[model samples]
Target chain A: MDSSQRQLNRSYLLRGLTDGIPIGLVYLAVSFSIGLSARTIGMTGIQGFFMSLTTIASAGEYAGLQVMASNGTMLEMIILTVVTDIRYVLMGCAFSQRFAPNVSLLNRIGTGALITDEIFALQISKSGYIKPFYSYGAALVAVPLWAIGTYLGIIVGNIIPEFLVSALSVSLYGMFIGIIVPPARDNKAIAICIGASFILSWAAEKFLSMLSTGTRIVILIVVIASAISLLFPVADEPAKEAAQNE
Target chain B: MNRITLYIIVMAATTLLVRVIPVLLIRKEIKNRFIKSFLFYVPYVTLAVMTFPTIIECTKSPIAGAAALVGGILAALKKINMFIVAIICCVIVLVLEFVL
Candidate 1:
């Protein structure tokens, strides 16, 4: 390879290492508790690890576990997974745009496999073409971390106190709070959307239990509230400026 | 199908369906200004709805809520990292639960 190409390759590897650390830590913390929760509900360690590897989503995985624990049908689990992960469709689409200019079909598909919300956030913030290898590198580190964390959580869960496990369950919520509150604090429209979805879903769950359609209503609330909020004219100031410059 | 096998199939299919359909449908960059801006805020909204209330109620004591709220606000301002904020909240809850 040429000097510039070699330099690019080196930087990509470094980027992967740096990004992978934080992502892996988050996965360990979050998935560890998820493992405990699954075990608490009677899943074996092998089951939880396989679930994490196949799903790679906290919300969807949790929902699936709830369905399994409740002995809900396979059809219910399938529907829940699809509904909860609808946002990923948009995320993948956006990531693909960033790839379309320079990446080959094989590279795009390969790198796209690793495109989670966190990775998409960091990648989208960067300038210029995305190197597929960097994504592969990040995936190499992150996938193993997720699988290992599940194993560790299951093993550690056997020895940990019940109260401690319960407390750690809150950590997932804590991480989500950390992610959401910062952005919502600055964005009024977004704050409204969040509040609306929560209220609507909460109401549905409480009052619509007799209807035998609680989950679908919750999903509907989220999608409708989010869609309406986006229709409003107020633009995020920083994002507006970024768009203007682009 | 076995439960795990069913899960694997459902998840793989969901991932592929979500990934592929949009890529095929949108032939050009999504230049529609409104849709683009909407997309940007969706995650924030999703996060808030999913996380905010739980932050308030995760502990038995009300004081835990106070600590988490404070830590979350601090983290929001970028005064400290997420680890510090999470630790602050967790410690407060742990200590208070032990004390009370």
Candidate 2:
């Protein structure tokens, strides 16, 4: 490859790494609790590490751990995880639109494998077509930290103080706020959609408390995003041309 | 195979499938304006839906969580660096959980 093309790839990778640092840090903190839960279920630190390594999702893994704790059957585990993580399908659909058309199948598969909530948020919020190198860079930092954090959580087992854990847990939420707020501030339609999301989410939590959190989220996304899209369709843009390199 | 190992494999395979299939299948750009618009707004709505009342219940004390939520929103509105905004929210939670 030419030096100029290589340089561009490096820059996107660097941008992704920089953007991914906060996500990596938050994953470290959040996965610590998952590790602790693994320990409570009598799983070893190594097992927790592998679990986090392979399953980078927070909610799905937590639910899986609960299933293991209860000795639920494999069939039961599959159904529960599919239900819990079905949101990724929608997220993947949305994310697929951001790929430059000529990106290779391998790169697309690799990118899809790393689609956690925070990484998806970071990538989707970017202005135009995204390079696979960016997601690669972010996953480099995020994936390992997540695995190591789970390992540490199992091995360390509650050494961290309670107040500190409480504080750290909210960092993920704080990052979510940072992502949505700026865009909402810039666009009126987006602002109204987010406002409606907040109310609907809260009502679902209060009134539909029996439903799993995942189900509630899926229902809200379909309802709010569809309604908002109908009311305020984004102006169509010409199809983005494939960038020079794969 | 050990039971935990089986569980991990099953969990990982299913989760990865959910994320991978869409990207593999939807190669061409979507033409439908409504579908494109819905995809466009998915990130904002999804993130907001995940953050609300949920954020308020993430901490040891609901009050501390709520205070941090307000602090986080204000900090984010100012367009502060996301990492710094998270740190600010963490501090708010730390202080409130201590005092209350």
Candidate 3:
């Protein structure tokens, strides 16, 4: 009986690892460009490594790097970090429903730190109820793989030719689009929101010279999400309940 | 700590707090439906916002980047694996860069 329980835990854990490996590989490249960009803006490989450990956010780090490179104040950096990371608040709330019923507070904090866009997407798409072990299995693979990529990005970015780095940098955006498309295809609200954000982000950046990228996104997400939720409050409630009870 | 080190610490702390505080405070499962669906779509939207415009800026040329974006959308629409989608888009960027 004990062995059977162990086997059950082991199988879920393995399932999680399988779920995480692809995400880890993408992190390896995406954050490599992050490490490259961080190095370009006067940070060391070690700093990039530690920063990736903490943030694991490609865009937030870019925003932070912008503040640093521009000689922006600490106040600016702090605000930028908060503004860019605002989505995590949403992701965290969604993740709350996923933890094993008896999950500890420490485990919550640990898993929270590891929840990036990739990890959240992978875990939420997971069928059936999830255990703490499953999240740990995914985190165990993803977080370190991201850190390694950052370290290599900082260390090896200098030695690599400039042209190839630009090419690799483009891969991160492809990965971002990749993550969202499958889910968006099935959900119209999501698809519309994706379309709105994409068009608005592009327009705001190219035409609205006065608005910064962070502010533009803050406005776009708030406006689009609020607008959609107001229009369609009943869209996913039943599904949410089903997921929670599952 | 010096200013740069302090800078690093602050950025890290703010991002970590954004992630951890919500999870810590909302220990019970939230029952609000609007909030749930709102959170559900945030990842897709935020990620989308990050991708466009910036994607073009990531590549050497706008045309190459646009090509890569279309390829990425295709790979995704096809329901390919995440890593393969990324790889296909990367290859598109490389080939387009070479061609253009």
Give the candidate number with the greatest TM-score.
Answer: 2
Task: State each candidate's chain A TM-score.
Answer: 0.66, 0.92, 0.75
The lDDT leader among the candidates is 2
For model 3, the superposed segments whose C-alpha errors exceed 4 Å read A1-22, A30-44, A66-76, A97-101, A127-135, A153-157, A235-246, B1-3
lDDT of 2 by residue, B43-81 (tens): 788899999988878899999999988999899888786
> Which has the better DockQ: candidate 1, or candidate 2?
2
DockQ measured for candidate 2? 0.78
Docking outcome class, model 1: acceptable
Candidate numbers, best lDDT first, in rank order = 2, 3, 1
Question: Arrange candidates by TM-score, highest first: which order?
Answer: 2, 3, 1
1 or 3, greater by DockQ: 3
Q: Which portions of model 1 show Cα errors greater than 4 Å? A: A1-13, A36-44, A66-76, A94-100, A115-138, A152-157, A161-246, B1-3, B19-27, B60-62, B79-100
lDDT of 1 at B53: 51
Question: Candidate 3 - CAPRI tier?
Answer: medium
Q: What would the TM-score be for candidate 1 when compared with the true structure?
A: 0.71
Error of 3 at A207 (Å): 4.0
